[model samples]
Target chain A: MEIASFLIVFFMVRYIRTSLQTAVRFPEWERILVIVQYAASGLLAADVFLDSSITKWLWHLLLLGMVGAAYLLKDFRPVRNVWLAVGPYILVSLFKDIAKLIDSDFYESISTVVEIAEIFTLVWLIATWVSTQRQQKALEKERLKRLQEEEQSRIIAGQNVMLEQLVAERTAELTRQKEELEQTLTELKATQDQLIQREKMASLGELTAGIAHEIQNPLNFVNNFSEVSVELIEELKEERRREDRDIELEEELLTDLTQNLQKITHHGKRADSIVKGMLQHSRTSTPQREPTDLNNLADEYLRLAYHGLRASDKSFNATLIMDFDEHLGKVSVVPQDMGRVLLNLFTNAFYATEQKRKTGLAGYQPTVQVSTKRLSDEQIEIRVRDNGCGIPKTVLTKIYQPFFTTKPTGQGTGLGLSLSYDIVTKGHGGELTVETEEGEFTEFIIQLPT
Target chain B: MKVLVVDDETDVQILFEQRFRREIRAGELIFAFAHSGEKALAYLNEHPSEYVLILSDINMPGMSGLELLRLIKTTYPAPPPVVMMITAYGDSESHDQAMQLGADAFLTKPLDFNNLKEKLKSAL
Candidate 1:
């Protein structure tokens, strides 16, 4: 019984410590039961050495009180287990006492039955407590697993949002770079066109100069021979007058000869003018200002440029619209330079309209219009407008810059417009401006102060 | 008086003959012709004393008229034929160059025959 008491005390103390460590509330009734059980155990231990029946009886009474206290605290897990374990033992003790009092022969069998019942109850209590503890542990493990999965999913969701943001930012950057690349490509194309135009103009100028030089010798021969023929005819006429034979026939022959000579003079002068024009076109000359008729100058250059284009491309044709202000009268300008300016503008106008015609667009009629208006007594305005493939807005600002041309290689010397601009603005103290809409029409306006 | 006309164009011979027909028939003036500057130089070498005047075209395929004038002024015998340089290019630069190279007269073409006749008579 002493050893049993020690073992029970040890188990009870360990259980209380475990409950306290686990932060489980210790009930008031349970505390009292524990103190009573300790006192009972002490009493029982003293009786074992002293051999005192009173001490034993006191221990039995304390044990009965402990059982009653356990019953009152039965809602607590540890107390319920203790009450189940101790109740059977206490009942058995009471039964033993009754049997002794009755003086029955069944006392020993009853005690054996009581002992079996106690052992069974103790086993059941231990099993119930252990099962409850294992169930609680499993629930805690499940909750922790669920919390961890939630935390991992939250992290993954944050990463997904960051990845999407990065993708959007990269896409925006790519679009910006593509725009920049396109802008650069356009500029490069314009520069390449300018360079090709410059090369073509340089070669054409050289070729035209050579042709002018070669033509001069023959032109001189024609003019000189015609003049000498007239003189020889005059000498022959003088001799015939002195001889006085076949006078009527001689006069008829002389009249025929003089008419033929006049024809030769007229054609020779025309050839001279053409050769001079070619030479002037090939060479850059100092500006010489004189009173020039704006109407005649515009008319002359418009026809000249049209003929020049026709000489190059036989299939090209356009209806020229000329609206000259006859009242504009004479303006003080360098006629040669102004003529060049008009020629360039007219040529560009014709070229634009011709290009539009080549696209095979039905009902497209190429037309270039040249108009002059006297804005005031001091200012004259000249406009060359075309219903053609207009200048694109992107390239409009660069047209006056040297070497900027829309024409293909070998067709233009981008210097035409640039030189014209220089002649009008810098050389003549005038203004040159342009108006255009892409794919619709283009107009160049020159305003000169008379 | 004998005059030498040096030119590449063969038609120039006809023009001169027609213009001065009376003078040639009256034995007042004689004319000779050479096709190029080199040929003119060869002619001068052969008949150094026969010619009184040299009218040479400035531009020629070989041995330009200017170079021929330089040779005639420096290497020819004393009293070399009066050298005249003519060109279709009437630019001041050619005129200046011809005068600098000892040409007696620099003429531009479509030659004014009346003025040329006066100049030729005055020189004679």
Candidate 2:
């Protein structure tokens, strides 16, 4: 029974040594525990195999050495961890040996229970350490993921801020550019107006030459007529002198000659008046800018303009309406310039009516209404409204542009309205604007300072 | 030939008379006068083709010289008497139109009688 008990203890130590060796090499203490456990198992197994008294005693010494090693290693040293792995095997071996020395079955059972309890404790410690390592690795992975997410969010926010700033900066730049573009457009318009004025002056020079020739043609008539009168006077004087004896006959002849001379003078003076009106129409450059009643100016030009239209197209008859504001005070403007403006307006009105008549517009009774009003303390407004064929909406924008005209090539110079616009806006420091619809009516508004 | 002289200014008549005194004595021309466009047209209508040439102003109150020229060119196409367009400002637009409308010659004033004579000789 003693030998059997020794063999069982030897086999248990051998199995514990194998279990320790199979455990992964972890902490340095655990490696040392595994090595000591291996040596202890070998010594116990040899004692059981030899079955000699000296071997038994040596096993007893070996067990004593193991217990001493356990106490020395137990002071929290690396060997203490090593012993913990081999501790169960060494204890089992010592308990069996002591049980053999005592030769008692009851003590052997208690030693066996203590050895099993120690082995179970070693396995529980190893499992606790492995699970702790796995949990630490998992925690590190979670921290890394959280840090990456924070960094990604920061990067996205930074990009959005930069984009917002970029858009704001671009909008500011665009606003400045738009303002500059508008300024440039206004400057271009002013320059264009000056150019038109220069061109109109050049055309006026041309008209001056035309008027000079026109003046000379009538002058030629006056010369020829007076010369004929002189010849007739000489002939009458000679007849009176040659037939001095026939007094009654000479007197009758003299009376007839005097009557013919008076007739000639009458027709000559009538011709002269017509030429003078033409001269006045053409020579209008020397403007007299003064505080003049625009209403009176409109009325005067309206008559001349209507006469001109009647002369040009004898068949056309259009009504001229004057709605001059009597209460409106005088405006500081060139009266002659304003007169020309009115003339141009009336002429355009008459021409439109003529066109409408030719086109067979039903009941197209042309009406031109000249109206005025005081808009404010500093400004007065004059409106020239025409019920003749209205300006087409598409062409309204180009009406004030120089050299833009609706009339045929020979009929109109296309500078009339452009000149009027310049005179009103630049010369008088006023405003000229128009309102019109395609088949309705056209109205030109001129505003000048009071 | 009985020629009509139409003019508004008395000074222009005096100058013309002083210039053409020698011609009158030689019976080279006869003259009657009307200054305005209406008078000139009336005279021309009364004595159509009687005058050798019509010296017409472009701008006149009763009727423009252009209107008179158009009337003359259209009414009397075959035996149309010569017309010499004269202006101080000889604009290309007016000059070209006048020539196209069968004006014999275009003359710009102050009147050069020497050029006038040459143009008249050519037309006659």
Candidate 3:
């Protein structure tokens, strides 16, 4: 009976030790279960080779260790799972107690029941072991799946870092290109300014011939008046030299001489002014601001440009039509630059009219008109119009481009309008625009901000 | 002799009066002045045969001396007046054109009054 009980106790201890080992997280409890199994094996050896008293002591020690193992296992997992081992342990104890209580006749029947209970305990151990094995296999597969997911995440993180580096490199390259383009734009602006200065100087050269002719008109008056003054002085001297001078004749001669001297002085000053005007036109100094009357400026340029044309082609002439704004106030402008722009516009207007006159169309009196207006408190407008060969549609857009000319090769430098446009718009923050018809007229409008 | 001088310069009136002062005062030559070609033509139309000689500046605005000469020679109702074309331009082209237009003489500006007097004497 003791051997049978020992066998059941030993298997129970072995089964729990094996099951607890699979719960490796609780290694201390598995260690306790191993000690319990060792105690049961020692008790089995005592039951087989030692005296009954020593065997009984070993049996009690084994039971004490089993109790401690059961308590430790219960603390690790579900208390209900503990009952699988505890219930069999209690049944084995009951079978040991009943085996002692049963008589010879009753023992035969009870022993069969005890054998069946032992077989049931063995089957329970086998079933629990199989389920533990399956649980361990599932846990192993989950661990492998987690490792693969972690590796995939690491690869994705590395790709993200590479993409960030690529974006940084492209941004640096774009920044370099942007700086280069800005430098190019600055260089273009400087070259444009140089070209504008050259064009202004070229126009001054073209005006030199016209300026010479204009000076001739005033010089003619000066020379004639001075020569007449010399004759008047001689006539007075002759009157004075007479033995008895006629008072009335002497007074009259003296009066004529005085008048002649005054005329000479006046015409000399006029010649001086014309020279001064020419000097102003040809000046290459930087622009200086002054208050200027547009009406007076326009009127003066109109004649200057006309004389310029007439001097070149003696027969060329036009009817000058001008209407100026009486209420237009003096505008602040760079006088020399503004004067050049006005001269260019007036020259163009007269040229157009002269060309129209050459066509010899009957009743065609060539007319060039200029008008000035105070368009608003912030703006002043000057319009120069000519009834002449109008600008063609195709070349209208290109008119403001540098070196674009419609005139015969030697006649036009082609920088007049382009330079004028820059002076008005960039220099003064103004706008230059044109309106034209194919055969009727061309009007250039300059809008200046006050 | 009645002389009509046409020029845009107002100073010409005084200059002519002073230059021909003796002839004017003695009444050997009577002087009248017009500032433009149109005025000169109007003066002629108003007093027919009053002016025997016309001295005109060729470059006057509105109507040039050449145009005035052509009009006086071909269009005037009375016997054609003797016309002289005067200009600042002393080019041969202008002198020839003025001569072809029936001008009695062509004169350049800063006019040589002595030469003018000689030409005037011969033409008269």
Interface RMSD of each: 14.2, 9.2, 2.0
In candidate 3, what are the lDDT values of residues A144-174, reduced to their tens digit? 8888888888888898899889889989988
Q: What does DockQ give for each predicted structure?
A: 0.11, 0.07, 0.26
TM-score of each: 0.41, 0.40, 0.65
**DockQ category of candidate 1:** incorrect
- Candidates 2 and 3, the one with greater lDDT: 3
Docking class of 3: acceptable
Every candidate's lDDT: 0.72, 0.63, 0.76
Stretches > 4 Å off in candidate 2: A1-127, A146-330, A333-379, A384-390, A395-431, A437-442, B1-58, B61-124
- Give the Cα-based TM-score of candidate 3 against the true structure: 0.65
Which residue pairs clash within candidate 3? none
- Provide the interface RMSD of candidate 1 in angstroms, 1 decimal place: 14.2
- Candidate 3 chain A weakest ten by summed lDDT: A76-85
Instruction: Give the runs in model 3 whose Cα sits over 4 Å from its true position.
Output: A1-187, A322-331, A371-383, A390-438, A442-450, B26-32, B37-44, B47-54, B69-83, B89-107
DockQ of 2: 0.07
lDDT of 3 by residue, B1-124 (tens): 8889999789888888877887788888888889888899899999898898999998765677788888899888777778888887787878888899899888887788889887777767
Error of 3 at A94 (Å): 22
Pick the winner on DockQ between candidates 1 and 2.
Answer: 1
For A291-357, candidate 1 gives per-residue lDDT tens digits of 9888877875676666555434544667678898878989999876787788788878888988888
- Candidate 1 local Cα displacement, residue A408, angstroms: 26
